[model samples]
Target chain A: MACDARGKTTTIKILTGLLRPSEGQAYIWGVDVEKEPEHAMSRVGAVVETPELYPELTPLEILTYVGRLREMSPDAIRDRSKVVLDEVKMSEWADKRTGKFSKGMKQRVGIAQALLNQPDLLILDEPTGGLDPRGMAEVRDVIKGLGRSGITVFMSSHLLYEVQETCDSVALINKGKLLMYDDLARISLWRKGGRVEVEALPPIPPEIVERVQAAPGVKSVRGPDGNRIVVELEGGDEERAALLRQLLGWGLRVRSFKDVEMPLESLYLELVKESR
Target chain B: MATEGATQPTVPQAPQPTVPQADRRTARGARFLIVARFELMRQLRRRRLLILLIITAIFLVLLIVVIQVFRTASADSYSYASSFGGFVPTLAALAATFFGADALVGEFEHRTGYLLFPQPVTRTSIFLGKLVAGFSLTAVTLAVYYGVVATATAIVTRGLPIEIAYSFLLAVLYSTAALGVAFVLSSTLKGTTSASVMTFAVLFLMLAIVTAIFSVADLRPDGNLAFAGGTISNILSGPYPQAYPGDTEFPGGPGPGGRFRVYSPAVPLSILVMAIWAAVGFGLAWALYRRKEMKG
Candidate 1:
């Protein structure tokens, strides 16, 4: 989900049984969180908004502590700590104290502990909120890997790109209101229309641009941004292919013609603006 | 990175392990021990424990220096042990405030609760675990101090007073009461330093003020933990000090003040009062902790 400073964290907190809702009830895996928090929380492994670990302890010790809380056997904690630590790429630092760890390293450890219980559901809140580019990519990769492992991952972030890259479905919220909830593809292609970027040899004339614009199912043609022009086209794959063919027949040396990917940022902005 | 259209290698996922079903009592008991063990380790690693031990050593040395300076070599073993136990209440308060002042509050203040509170364990388990750990640390410190006094009494007076054991028991009771108060403050306060200062202040300054008021008003300060702690030393006196309530000639004569009022609760009553303080303090702390939220 993508939401700006709204109630995303609050909702996640309630779901994780951190806060008792003033009204309304929430459930996790058929168990009411407020009614049976221990049972509900047992199924969930969560990292809520920059979890801070005990600096005096090593990652191994911290994970062991969490494992014990989960009521796992000592042998299980040992074996599982190794696997989860490796999953987050924190095995090398497992025994090292977290006091002097970099933010990225600590974040990785946070993810590691959340995975220690082998929970059925994983919830992360802005896993890459504060990190360098490399750290963000690494964390995104870890999150994506977890998603592919079949554990249901529900993550909330304001970064559209991160959600776009890491999540299969998206839930957008604004002003504590859920604006939309659907698969990523559906939201990105909600209008049954998209922009197609065309790259051809330089010195292409304006007649071709006009012809492309006048083609059936084409909404508008914008910019020869360097060697590229973005054609706003309606309908699906067949119409886009037909337009590419017509452009080729117009005696234009079209090097490439591909549908421009609609960034989730645009959809998020539009949805948020419309909500307001 | 796997590119688009490339067949992604199937990574084996970790097995989803369900938490084993133990009887609720056994599970809570096991978790309590685990938390207490780790909590104890956390406290043991801190420099504050060492600081408290060093302070105890300094106080012991001071006791020896005073004994030599005052030339009280003829004092009996009971008097020597009583003098040693006299410092128990102050040391116990210091120990409780130092070890337990941030016991619960630190979880929120230092952001550790963000990780801890989401676990499957119940808040009751966490509270009891922390209380046991704090009590253990305080009790152990008191034990060590009393152990030294016992050894000194054995060496200097060539005899051990049986009352030393009772004195030690009262000292521990007093410390537990102090720790209970500290835990209450820790759970309710938002900052660790404030909780620690408030605990020390409440135990020493605030309670002392209440005891003094009770004394001046000619009411027995039996309910005051500060006044009740006097039983730790009073038990060692051959003839326990009798309550000279209302007005009487000063024990030290009218050298300074003319008349003085004294208040002393019996040993059994003092023990009961201290136990009540500890129990009520812990019960109140647990109640507050159960409802406390980690807003930050």
Candidate 2:
């Protein structure tokens, strides 16, 4: 969806009917992109990277113009344009020239343009690239709302956290090769087992490292401090209990046991490294 | 189990709602129009475009003023009529060429093509729409200039011959041809500067270089009509011509000075040439635009 080139985010164009895969086919709503491009693309609304707004036209005029091209009645164009502008929180600036808009505002306008037809499939590349925190939240909420409305959103972003927060599923690519493709939650689960940090009552003995390493389902053991022992295990309730039992069998006192959620950033790094 | 079986057997029913395909098509068409209209309006609002129009208007006014000044100073109606009427088409062609040459290339330079190409509209529609807008703008300016000049001339002298009206129409046609050629160049060249420079250079070469070459060759001894015809032929083939219709006469024996020899591109030939250039230029532009990757 997106990649960093010299520290700038570059999004690959993924228009519905335009691009054809070398080995496979892309489709939109069961229409094959290659064979039935017009039909395939009919249901899609997309903005590649930057807003392609005409700087000379007001946002309202722009929406109406594109609406006319779609053969919509004048009233429908106006109604939809207003609705979309409001949805993106750009109603106040709709009358202003797009050339004068801020980058964030332009991105919002781009989103509104993409949503104009109420597309069944919306492909946005870095839809929130230039947004502030609140703007990003608004965009994410809008996307979430679209998903609820049964619009399949396929978006690309370099921000792992944003993708993690926003996407229902993702296909990660590196060097033009697919690295991973699955639900975000499931991919995170697959990357590495969740970590458990324990504060030993009697302090973890350096000599008991071998015993902890030999514990059932305990993949690795390490200590950053004298009182704390971090254990990596294969995830599952049974595996967790077996590791705890082994630790108790070793006569080690446990002061606390807490599971740490694996951050998507860390998982991404691990996956990238593994692929290499 | 017997009690459950005895109870009315319940079956899950699928939702029987239907959304006609026509409704979906209407939605998609609406989206395409939004993008197309936005593109048209954005281009119409550029500062450079406004400035170009203003400059053209000022030039037209200056031409009128110059003609009036000459008439007042010398009390010569012939000079004023000849100077102003002769130069209109050439001036219009130059103005149209200057603006139209960069129409498509400017989009590439600004990286705005990336934004429009992804929508549902075909590349042909985008190219044609932009071309239509550019032509409309040029035509409007030319019309205003024509009206202004005609009004000024009427005020300066009693009235001009009907031939001037014919010349003005020819000028508009010539200007449109120049625009088509420039649009073609814009599509061919990726850089704005290169496209602009090359388009103007070609125009000049077609008009000046070919004429100069024919003069040096001494192709015609008794009459320059042969050379003029050759130059017109060359202009038709080449990308640029210095002297558009009514600009100046071709070099050789008989020039614009000859009362017996008239030097206008045949009306049908002019129309045909312009149509050919527009079709070819726009055809090439459309092809390149379709294949162009909006990577920026």
Candidate 3:
């Protein structure tokens, strides 16, 4: 469940034109970030690491400045800044200088500034980093709302739980190398077929273990320890049911039954170690 | 997925209704004034800018009082006021250095570039806008400083000369040249303190070196910004210092051939010198800012 948050940050920066990729191309909206960053990065909104802002500027001023920089007219900047501040729940303090604000408040203003132009791709690099639980939750909720509005949200978090809790599709990288990329639901499904572990009253004979492997849909069998056996099956629930029946009929004295997980941790360790 | 229609942004809810989009043509264009407007505001809001203004104002008042108290035989000369206009560029340059030295560096050191650079605006626009903003504030300070000098001179001579306006224009150009130099430093350094301090060093310390080199070689100092700035105020005092003899009034002067011939920057040449400094300084600063990547 470890995450290479820094690697993800590097990718975002490259895409946003803040950093250049030395060996390969990085593109945003089909425009090469290096050659056409002005075109590509224009549609992106990013909050990298912490929310850094001018301490002297009020939240209203910062957002208005960003809106103006994006070439929004005075009327649009005025209207949009109000909306952005309200979205970040800082409407009341909109006129107050951010110097006096807390980290959470500063972060809110940062998020508000990013939304001033209504960007197409919103990249949040550890948006909740270094926040109290409440602060983290507050930012998390804000990000969730952004995603619902159909903005393509790209967020990086070192916490597996946070990624699982926040992202749609997950990309896991370590040491600048991509480890996995897939639907969030299927990270635990690195390989096909379910693994089932069975505990028996006594060790099944080696012959019985072999017979179980020979059963329909059973791809492999391991362990014939004094008490249990492990089965890797190539079929769905129906095939699993048939294998359990075959094992029971063999009188292997089955005492317990359950599905086991793929060794993702081991797989990750091996992948990282090998890449190293 | 956990993010599917989840997490509420703390916004007040109104009834959901279909709405048309607003035009974004302006938002997609490159304009420095957008940045300049806020940058001007940002410059004005800082406490250091105010402190510099107050101190310069105090210096002008002291100069006036010194003339009033001494009652020299040429009390009606307003000579002090004329010479003081010459120092306006130095003061204005100092003020520019204070604000502009950290102009671009603040964006990165304060981490504001993380927000600022990602916007659709080009870096060229940002650099140009910030220079305009920095120069604008410096101009305001120069105006206030000029006001004191003019009032002081009018009180002594009972009338102000046309040279006051001419000098004011020159001072504004000199101030811009200062900002351009500071911008060069700001864009090259990574930290606010380093950039600001180095700008002061360049304006003062490095200036001494350039002057020394010109003197040791007995060369005309037309290329020096400080020398050009002196000519801006020198015009207000009297005719531009004449050939070879130069301004005996200017230190290390009377030129190489004594009174036989001296070299001082002529009025038009003085302006051209400042213009050249302005051009080169802004050009180099913009180039550095444009190429800089945000590795930090």
The C-alpha TM-scores of every prediction are 0.84, 0.76, 0.81
Model 1 pairs in collision? none
TM-score of chain B of 1: 0.86
Stronger candidate by TM-score (1 vs 3) = 1
| Candidate 2 deviant stretches above 4 angstroms | A1-12, A16-25, A32-38, A192-202, A216-220, A230-245, A248-276, B1-44, B47-53, B68-82, B85-90, B97-99, B153-159, B191-201, B204-207, B214-271
RMSD of 1: 6.0
What stretches of model 3 exceed 4 Å from their correct place?
Answer: A1-6, A34-38, A71-83, A175-179, A192-270, A273-276, B1-19, B24-30, B71-78, B239-263
Taking the tens digit of each residue's C-alpha lDDT, what string does model 3 give over B1-296? 12222232232222222222335565444468888888878777887679888889788777777767876766443355575765676686687787699988888888878878777677887887888788877887888888878877787778676677778898888878888899888989888888878888877668757866776566778788877776666667653333112543334445564432234566788799889998999999999888887775
DockQ computed for model 3 against the true two-chain complex using alpha carbons: 0.30
lDDT of 2 by residue, B1-296 (tens): 11111122222232222222223345543443444345445545555456656776787778777765655654433334445554444454555565677777776677555555555566556676666666666666667666765566567766644444544565566566667667778877878888877766665455445545554453322122122222223232212333334323343445444423224444455556656665766677678766655444
Identify the leading candidate in terms of TM-score.
1
| TM-scores, chain A, per candidate | 0.83, 0.79, 0.73
lDDT for B8 in candidate 2 is: 29
Task: List each candidate's DockQ score.
Answer: 0.36, 0.24, 0.30
- Candidate 1 regions with alpha-carbon error over 4 angstroms: A189-263, B1-26, B68-74, B239-258
Give the TM-score comparing model 1 with the true structure, all chains together. 0.84
Q: Which ten residues in a row have the lowest lDDT in candidate 1 chain B?
A: B1-10
What value does DockQ give for candidate 1? Answer: 0.36
